[model samples]
Target: MTPETGKTSIPIPERTRPPRAARRGAIAIRFRPGPAAIAAAALVCLLIGLLYLALQIRTIFSDQLKQEYAGLVLEAVERAESARNQVGIWQQLPDATEARAAGYRHARTELAHRLASLAALVNASPSAAPRLSPASFTADADLRDTDAVLGTVSAWWRAQRDADSADVRLRIAHVARTLIASAALLFCMLITALGMYAKRNRLLAGQSHEFEWAALHDAMTGLPNRRKLFATLEAAATKLSARSASCKIAVLYIDLDGFKQVNDSLGHRVGDEFLIAVSKRFRESVRKVDVVARIGGDEFAVLVREFSTNAELGEIARRLIACVVQTDLTMGVGMVSASIGIASFPDSVDDYHRLVAAADEAMYRVKRNGKNSYAFADRAN
Candidate 1:
């Protein structure tokens, strides 16, 4: 070695930051959280769960208030009967008959005021029970017809306010207990998740991504939801906005024909299975670049990112119509057809929203003209 180098320093490699994955892997092996830490976490979770249960009691309390108000209505009906009996006694009185008559009139007025309060309550919270207009109740509740008033009050209580408060309280208590237990389990899971996270955060991240995708995509057919469709449409719109003259996007709105009749005849389970099978056929028939989405009940939308001409779109539409007719479904979900409408950007409309509306209107026209066919918005009269 040279004398100058030997005096200056010993040879050493350059230092750099550790890789995130390696550091994360070391975390699990380096330290373990104690039982005390876990217990504290569990307590925090339990408190949060109790807070949720407390909020649910607001709804339970509202139901209890309804029962109390309904009981007041029954008492008013009893007061009406008492007033009628007082009227009879007043007529028989030889002395101080005028004072007794006044008392009867006071009772009648009190009953009317009570019913007015009850009618307001019923209106504030609408009930399926027969309409209880205060004027109608007062008209029918003549002093001579005491029994009718009593009968109506009893019937109202049975229908509108029959839900017992005790039942609501009991159910709430059961749910609270279940949630508390779930909180404990969640705490235990949290620690386990932490341990796994220490080993590999990427794995945990992947699981979270899957849950988010499920929310964005349909559960039944694994297609994009309406929200996803809107996002995709907006993205496409933005890209085409710059090159309005050259670029184009197509939105195909498809509604199944005679689906409701078959769904009603077979049952919802069969209908669901039928839709799943139909979705598979749609995925297979469409271009790989296109986005197929299940937007609503028996309604599917396809977004064509790019297309050459009207003939190209027409060919794709014909294939989709034929796919539905040719595909067979399990669970006895018989022959079904679709009515498809097509609208293109820059070709049909200037606005993106107007483009969607145009497609929807054209689909309805096909439904009216004849079923099991495709119609272009530009061609539709």
Candidate 2:
């Protein structure tokens, strides 16, 4: 199939392949991808959890404080009414001046005690303690009105006591309502902050995962590139290096024999198609344990970690060659062939670089000696 790159061509297997450079270049470009992108989603999730917890704490405090404030205000109003009634009866008796004065003294003391208790309750809330003040209750306009009404009744000791008592109760109720309103506002603000933080965290995490996937994959061929290949190889080598089993690493360098003619004859479009076809063939022919990579122009390498004999190696090479040679091309070119070079580790060379070099040398030998042959660098004893 024709690809978007317009660099290679797909032809029937019968046609000779195009230039190796075009095929390799196209494959490399197809698979290369950008670096890993940072995921902010995880961070976002963490922040959301924290913010939610904080909001919950705030809400609990607001609810508790509001309830407590309402109770205290009601208790204060009841105490004021009781004290006013006791003093009023003494004043009406006229002969009980000393008793009335003593009750008034006791009544003022009770009011002070109740106010202190309310202040203590407000301070007990961990979240609200820093924000609340004794002055908030005492300075409240409704509370002030209640205090004024109580003072007037105590000073006059007349028929105005019932009217003043009603005013004090209404004022206390108003103060409690104001406290609840303030608490509701605080709750809304906390929840809003939590929502904003959660949204930010999700965005960050999604980006991070997106970038990670991009890093491990090839952008074009959707295959693992050299970077991923080397990582796996390094890990495998470390595992095998510790063992002395008859384990062997086989490195194969494959080059398309007559690929240049395809590019020269049909055009670059057909050449790219031929390269994609070659990649597909390699995938189909290689064993499950083998990894193939397109390192550069028309050149592919395979790392095979298992194989007991040269015959086994030859079988794999023949399969690869056959896979490519047998492909049908529609570009009207003749049959194409591949030259494969094989090298083994611990048998031909000790180092990875030398091993690859040996395989490369063997591949050139195949090209020089004959186009469609597999060559080996290892000497037979």
**Which is the leading candidate under lDDT?**
1
The lDDT of each candidate is 0.74, 0.64
lDDT of 2 by residue, 1-381 (tens): 875676667875887787999999999888643221112433444455556556655655555555455455445545665654554455466565777778656655555555455445435534322322444334222445445654442343322333434555554555555456545554555555566567667777888876865686555444556666666667666667887768877778888877787778777777677767777778777777788777555677778877798898899899888767766354446756788899887787676556667888899999999788898986534
lDDT of 1 by residue, 1-381 (tens): 765645657789888878999888799657655445666666677777777667767667777777777676666556655655655665566777677768666656666665565556555553354546455346336554445645775686765566656666776887778786876588676776677556566776888899889988999899999888878888888987877567789988898887897779877887887788888988898888788999899998888988879788788788777767765344445557889999998788667877677888889989999878988897333
Distance from true location, Cα of 154 in model 1, Å: 99
**Residue 263, model 1, lDDT:** 75
Residue 291 shift from truth in candidate 2, angstroms: 0.5
Task: List candidate 2 segments past 4 Å from native.
Answer: 1-219, 328-332, 379-381
User: So what's the TM-score on candidate 1?
Assistant: 0.47
All candidates: CA RMSD (Å): 33.1, 18.0
